[model samples]
Target: MFRVDIREMLVEAQPQMIITNDNLNARVDAQVYLKVRADEDNVKASVYNVANYKLQIVNLARTTLRNIIGTLTLKSANSERGRINEELRHTLLSETASWGIEILRTELKEIDPPEDVQITMNKVVKAENEKVAAVDFATATETQADGQRRAEIKKAEGTKQARILEAEGQALAIQLVNEAAEKYFIGNAQVLRKLEAVERALVQNAKVVIPADTQLINVIGELAGVAPIPLVPKAAASPPDRK
Candidate 1:
């Protein structure tokens, strides 16, 4: 193992390296992960006039690693991630030369949710789906019932109209028949009077007459109550004497 002057290394601040027990740059080829955050950015450390130079690197490396861990844990917070946590690994990389540390790779690992939260999320999804289905069923039933009611009302109204029309037709037919009979009677009154006069003349001239009531006698009592008698020429009695 070679010796390293702490003051020279700190002032030069050259290539970054790692040290394990009493060895300066023993495993500089090997790199470790560092997660430093906002508060720890640009940290500079120099050992006092001191013990083994390798031991100094080792001690400083240990302290640096500890500080890195604390910073990562604080920023990560395990409950909610902060911007400090996201930049932690990168922030530490910039300090590599000053701190004499090499960071191999920073892993921002896969995000995982707690198992109980996942179960609760699934239950919420199921409840929402059931609500949607129930709403659909209720809406369909309401629409169907409303349609049926409308159809029934229309049918009833149609039946009532048909009955009314039939009754009106019957009444109109009866009225027409009665009107025809009354007009026939009123218009034939003059013809009826002429027939009655002829009938009375025939009854007076008849050799015999049959009356529905045999006991009753009908006579022309006076010329004053009667219309003027028609003039009839007497048959010549003298013509019989010539025979």
Candidate 2:
């Protein structure tokens, strides 16, 4: 009885230097999963159609990867990894159709560029990040300035409104005083004028003299709502007593 292991196997394509379509060299590695068909006819073919199928598959994988990589630039090889993996598996499946092997899946492990290329790519990424940060900072500054401007405008508007209200209140108070004076002091303007003169004299501490024949006493009596006193004339000395 002969024994053949009809199970899935894993193969690692060792990292090797390959020239890309753009003449740039890169180190590439991959992994492939494959299995032998379990049917009797295909099982026989797995043993007889190819000797040492594992080693043959490895060599085939290397050659296929070189060909595929040769067709792509280094940048494309790094960016379009999924496309490369799919293409590798499809090619393997087609080449091994008669070998009773199934190409299950393939994965690219690494696609490393040269040192100088790597440095250039890193610098590019850093520059892009810095540009984005600068733009964000400028936008934030502009927003803050706009907010301050609006706040100042609001403050100024509030001050203007307050001033307007105060002026209106003062004008209303003056109008009310004038109205009260007009209602109460219709024919009493002379009385008010005399009162004002007295007030100014009192404030200045001035000495004031009133003539005996003036109606000042009567005016004062009227303002105070008091009866006027009658001034009696003295008879001429009783004619010297008619001695």
lDDT of each: 0.43, 0.85
Deviating ranges (above 4 Å) for candidate 2: 186-243
Record all residue pairs in model 2 with backbone atoms less than 3 Å apart, i.e. clashing.
none
* Residues 1-243, model 2: lDDT tens digits: 657888899988788999999998899998889999999988888889999888888888889999999999988998999999999999999989999989899999998989998999999999999999999999999999999999999999999999999999999988985675576556778755765586578789999654453466665556568867787888776455564
lDDT of model 1 at residue 131? 96
The 10-residue segment with the lowest total lDDT in model 2: 210-219
lDDT of 1: 0.43
Clashes of each: 0, 0
Using lDDT, give the best candidate's number. Answer: 2
